[model samples]
Target: MGYVSQAESSFPAQVGKDFEEFIALSSVHCDGWGISTNDRQHAHAVLEKKVEAAAESATFQKVIADNAADGALLHLRWATKGLSISENNTHPFVYGDYSFIHNGSIFPPDSFSDFIDEKFKKLIVGDTDSERYFYLMMTQIEKLGLAEGIKTTLAIIKEHGKTTSLNFMLMNKESFVVGSEHNSEKKPDWAPADYYVIKYKKDADGVLFASSGWNQPGWHTLENHHAAIVNRSTFEIDVINL
Candidate 1:
């Protein structure tokens, strides 16, 4: 999941301005694209050849800047366990006003299927386990507060980790949560890969968090199993343990 909040006079009015270029570089993620804003204008686009082409075009950046949002989440999915790559099988799945995106799979979605409520089950419009996982987390958050919901969700994944990997990235208008193991089983070459989180207080009213150093100084690494919560306005960061 990706999160972006703009200052009143931010340099790039739209986060997608940069993100569309990023997505263009990520041809591997070809399923679909999902976007959300703090104002509740959610967009889920079916990523076809044309979309990819447009993402590569010069106008893509300007168009996204025109659609700038205060806070946004963008997703580019590489279909794994899902069916045909349609708009419905995209990332950044939304429920109510909440939006989520995932990076890893939760195998045997049916195994945890019963753990979710019927109402959430009805929201499953696609065949991806990632979407189900998103709904399950939403359901948990609805029943429990953010912290409790994370703990409960992690517990379920740890219990099932023996059979499947559950690496995920989730976010809403206020914050983002990333879950994953240290290594990638699919690409043995990435076994020693390390994940880091950086927190920054750009100004008295702005904070930023990112997985990697965005070529900016003061980017810090997030500890494993820790959650990074940023005050959307102040950019103050609070790292919480799950």
Candidate 2:
């Protein structure tokens, strides 16, 4: 999912500009890169092994810390579904201005294929249920607000979860949402075991919400079944119930 303001530049421009600055300032090393911008021109391709190697090198860390973004979503994928190693199979699936990524799977894709419209089912260019689920949520969100759309989307996934699990992340430039559901038949350990932590930093302008703790302190976790909305201008973090 990706979006771009008319006044702002293209998705790739924002990523390269912001990322280069981030590297310069933070000195962090990134293994892989994935981004979803405002226009849905999702780019999840792997950086060349050499690029990843360079990013992980000590010299690269100094480059990331300097950059800042009004809105950004980053993903480090450890593929759990889909076998294709190409960029299309990677994270940060983009559509319009929305970008999406998931950490879990929806099994027996054939069984739930009908729940998604034929048009969207056709838009599915990848084999992973993660991308399908992202499109499903996007279709719903276009019809409903983010929170309500997520709720309705979860209902559909729950209906299909008689055989699978849904643990995923959805983000636009302004808000970030995540949800998890498991099958009763499967043991807890067998279900998705990933956990997420969200932290907030209040600056004079507004707040910043990060996935993990930053060096400065004051980070928080987004509870299960909850969504966090960060106002782009105010930087206020609003927690919405799923």
Candidate 3:
């Protein structure tokens, strides 16, 4: 989940309400929880990572209640089969001014091996495929600009890897981006058809982007194979069909 306010302000109360509801889904996505607040001047970020269920942690609840920022990212993790649940494997991975969180699994975690820039490869702190995916995106964003970097990363994944979903939320000082890319045929048979769908709601103050499953009345669904790049300062959004 992510939010970008028009000015420096706290998130809407409804966002907090929706998050409480979202946390209930942790029965399945119970591996970990992570969140971060980015600086407005492209400075640094304040982040927290934990290997525990958000629903069960008082600290998580307090942090969510006290969090205030112009831009933020929160991630709930569901450990892929062989991946271990640990603090190091948590989401909202940070590098420089960027923060990222992914919600999918790709086989052979190092699928992007040679493609990943060595500078980023050395930054890998966990054994999950999600961390690797984050670095890959960073590498592209470093090579191309923002939008193109994201698009190119998804292209690389689709062309070479076997993935269940590529749904993710990434934020930096200037913007917040959400990507929804999932193979319906590859989703967990036990999960609902709309499990990978991502949605967002825009209002006078700012915009809120989140995953589906919880009740999100009147929220606009971001299409699969697409990404929404939202400018933090103006709240202007550019939807790219990838």
On lDDT, the leading prediction is: 3
Instruction: Write the number of the candidate with greater TM-score, choosing between 1 and 2.
Output: 1
How many steric overlaps are in each model, in order?
7, 40, 0
Candidate 2 regions with alpha-carbon error over 4 angstroms: 1-32, 37-68, 109-111, 162-168, 173-202, 205-217
> What is the per-residue lDDT of model 2 for residues 27-84, given as tens digits with 9 covering 90 to 100?
3323234544332233332221212322354432432343233344555544444455
lDDT of each: 0.54, 0.50, 0.85
Residue lDDT tens for model 3, 9-43: 54445375665678888878888899888858558
Give the Å shift of residue 129 in candidate 3. 1.0
How does model 1 fare in lDDT?
0.54
Candidate ranking (TM-score, best to worst) = 3, 1, 2
Better of 1 and 3 by TM-score: 3
Superposition TM-score, candidate 3 onto the true structure? 0.95
Each candidate structure's TM-score, on Cα atoms with residue i matched to residue i, is 0.73, 0.63, 0.95
Put down candidate 1 lDDT per residue, 1-242, tens digits, no spaces.
Answer: 34445443222432224433455534556655555444324443211122233345444344445544545555556667545677677666776556666655555655566667789999899787777777778778889977688678767755664333454555555555555333334432433343233233334434433333134344445565666665554545566776
Alpha carbon deviation, residue 59, candidate 3 (Å): 1.3
User: What lDDT does model 2 reach?
Assistant: 0.50
